[model samples]
Target: ILIDGALQNLDFSSGSVEFHNLVIERELNQKVMGGTEDEIYIFYMRFRRGIRVGIRLSKKILLIQLEIDSGFRNGTLGLLGTFNDNQNDEFVLPNGTVFISGASQTDQNLHLYGLHWRTQEISSLFKYDGTQSWSSINNLTFVPLFFNPNLTAFIPNATIRRYAQDICYGEGLNDPTPEQRKPCYFDFSVTFDADIANDTEKTLKTIDTAKKTL
Candidate 1:
């Protein structure tokens, strides 16, 4: 999913862009892959700048794999969010899966392709900025935005809250009381520095046009 108004041009002369603070989460229905009916969810959030350049592709891929279970095959794809003023193109994968992809100056939008009954299903991908405003690519409904409490299977609730608060407020800080703290918001940002200068604009326009027909 691409976030609106999150795109920016960098001064890097190497034809590469850097993204910071990207949060990617995926929820896979286990039944689709011959597993239990429960959903297998994975989330990745980067606090520092993440390299989107060519040479670091391997490292990035490794980072993604570390967060998710490797037993789930064909689920290795990662989501990209960006900011573009115009609508973007709808991508058709080799497996007959199709979905729209785009970016904007402040929002990131994505509609992920899934498999159901051997056919492709598209999930609504949404984005929220630092302000916590949300937007979706289509009229797609999403699961709850909050983290899955089950992620910390054996961890206690107090420990989870402490970790969450530390990550949200900053490290090396005392925990705050319930009244003094608020739920943490997941923020994401993206940058594209491809040689194609108008990629962002073109993608947005394409997405807008496609939306009318639906």
Candidate 2:
């Protein structure tokens, strides 16, 4: 069976069909200004097998990629993971791909979105690791440029911000008293760009202002 572009709920009885492979893809584009367009594509896949009637599981490969194009500059980013089962009972794949034992289930949920901005460019990418909820991984911003009198089209400075969030839940500690468990959240942000025309400061300030208002 094939599912496309949405979430699906499925249940199977024992000795039903077996899951072979799973694939996911997302593509997005953003037009900044003056006919310059930035495009992003992300692809991921999981390969698994069942062993000993749910006593052991095996995974082959996991991969992800990001491609960006903005008329003048183009770049690509990619990630790959391969699992080697030596003696461990369970293992978690790099890049947040999880492998579980003793559970016989499969699910697929995918989402895609596109946005256009005239004054500034904005783009975001998110993924759910199955261990926790979904969260954004990459965010980009593009700044406008103007031709200087030196007969050169000076590229205005811009900042590319990346963030990752993780949540951990604990049941309770040995306090001997009644207590509630809450999820611990971890979030961090990093900015990357070169300083040109003082545009980096301006763009960073704009982001800060927007966050304060929200």
Question: What's the TM-score of every candidate structure?
Answer: 0.20, 0.18
Per residue, candidate 2 scores C-alpha lDDT tens digits across 39-146 of: 422222323322111111111112233322233131111111123332222223323343432342111111111112111213223333445332232244423222
Cα error of candidate 2 at position 17, Å = 20
Give the lowest summed-lDDT range of ten residues in model 1.
Answer: 187-196
In candidate 1, stretches whose alpha carbon ends up further than 4 angstroms from where it belongs are 1-87, 95-156, 171-214
TM-score of 2: 0.18
The residue pairs found clashing in candidate 2 are none
Which has the greatest lDDT?
1
The TM-score of predicted model 1 comes to 0.20
Off by over 4 Å in 2: 1-21, 31-35, 44-206
Tell how far residue 161 is off in model 1, in angstroms: 3.0
lDDT of 2: 0.25
lDDT computed for candidate 1: 0.34
